[model samples]
Target: MDLIKTDQYGRQIGYVQGANIDFEVGADEADSINDFEIELKRWNWDGSIRYGTRVFSPDTEYGGIVREISTDTSTNVIRAKGDTWRGMMTKKIIQPLSGQDYATASGELNSIIKSKIEAEYPGLFYGVTADTGVTVNNYQFDRYCTLHAGLVKMLKSVGYRLDIRYQEGDVGMAGYVKVSAVPINDLSSEYELTNDNNMNFITDDNRRGINHLICLGKGDLKDRLVIHLYADQNGTISQTQQYFKGAEEIAAIYDSSGSERDDLIKNGIKELESKKSSMSYNMTMTKLEGNIDLGDIVGGKDYLTGISMKKPIGRKIWTISSGKEKVVYKLEGET
Candidate 1:
């Protein structure tokens, strides 16, 4: 396990101890913001106040870069906290023409966003261009929002699911990002947890059908109930009509593009399906244990529930001067 520390200019100044280097995979909030943290011994750098100088680190993982580095000086350690490349998507605000080809506009904006970050912190990431197949239809809007949120909107405009992954590397790779995308129903489940592996805060809330997905339409499409049109026709479900106070329509930039209305309906259906079964657990794995990729499906049997499937959800890593560093994988899944 190796963690190469870099200076503000992405220079290899020093290497931190693998034993003192503590990190984990995270999905801390509802947005599933996948992040990783590095808590290491304070290092010597120039032009920066005690851990104040901006620094980026390309750890021994799969070319993943930690965009920011701070310190946990309380313990005489330099703690660097960072999120996945997706974090770049939120740092900027987006405002595209409603009539612009949704696909072209998004591609352009994504390129623009990456341009700013890549100029500073260059990593071994796979997509420095518009290789990701995410697209949105031309939608007129008189607003501004986080480009990350907008990317989610564009992703839903098409039928794709975001699949996020994080792993504390193998034999020598420490940890790296294996997957972060605008789509991932392609997730696989794993049965890697057992009593030998410590686990805490495990719970499951299974409701046969308790999802109410509502999409508000703007203008003439206001108060339109498209639930039945998109929701499951399974006889074991119930629904209601509701008003969408802030719904707006977006036409596709291309003649062969998907209908805006159809996009919204499909988006709603995805939400409902995700609510089918909910499970939560806090599984603690030794730093040397198996790999954990955020947003991937993990299947296992608990001391109580016997067997179940879980989605790796949240993470919190603890760094100690005692040399006992550990990683926690917060898993949530729909059965």
Candidate 2:
């Protein structure tokens, strides 16, 4: 319930009322909750403060950049605006760039985040975290478009999330941009939605029939991504046929013709299915704590629907607003 403003170096400059801070802090989208934004408003403020005077609530620990400054010198009217740390990255649209073959492993990915990306874009990353141990697969990039798009696509393809950890990072690190590889719905926390607790629960059944995917690759070998072992292609997908019948065919940027292409192909199918198959549940928790952010797993119950979700599910916070601060979450599991 507090909003503090800081200078470019994160030194406290001033503070604002909690009501003046309005933010959409959750990755509410189905699976690609890549980023979130915050907005601060004030009736009268210092216009001479200049740029880089950031503001953010201590809850997120993520600093925001003062990008927009509105002022009328004649009337002495003024206003200033800013966005969260991730907002800075989304604006950095990358151009079409091609690169030679590169090996992508858990360690290599972390190295890229720490060295290459962080070097190019300073003050964005803090450190890396536990990654699913996978083989060193040869991969290449051709026109990533943007860091956000490329990073999310690559991470989602591998059945993982490029989670943004706002608090509690590496031992020596003391800033933002701590990325982690967290599997979706790796439900680890549990919660109960009693009649008086849960505001409401909504369920959605994906009937687009995009349950299966035909992942295609590129180059002379026409390197196709292998997905049979990791995902179901013939049984569960082929069984249903109503609209957009059968499997969903998609194209991928295949750069190599090695056995390692398995990761690429598998990731492609998983990325699609992550959005295609399965039911989605959304519930409003009356109160959300600072610890409950993106990439955390929790469970809830909907007694009215008579649908008692058996297992705990991974969820992402989509929205956070003041005045009782109604928080909404998108659940990732079966109901």
Where model 1 places Cα greater than 4 Å from the true spot, the runs are 17-89, 98-126, 129-145, 149-189, 206-282, 285-292, 313-321, 332-335
The number of the candidate with the highest TM-score is 2
The alpha-carbon lDDT assigned to residue 6 of candidate 1 equals 43
Candidate 1 residue lDDT tens string, 69-127: 66566776665556544554455566555775332343433443354334433442222
Q: Tell me the tens digit of each residue's lDDT in model 2 across 1-335.
A: 45555656555656654333344433322343333343323444544344776565553534465676665666554555555555555555444435633323234454444544575567656546444663224433335345554554555556554555444224333335465555555343445554566357665544443444444444344344433312233224322243342245322232334435556555555565564545566665546544554545555555556544422233333333453444455444322
Using alpha carbons, what is the TM-score of model 2? Answer: 0.57
Report the CA-based lDDT of candidate 1 relative to the real structure: 0.42
lDDT of 2: 0.47
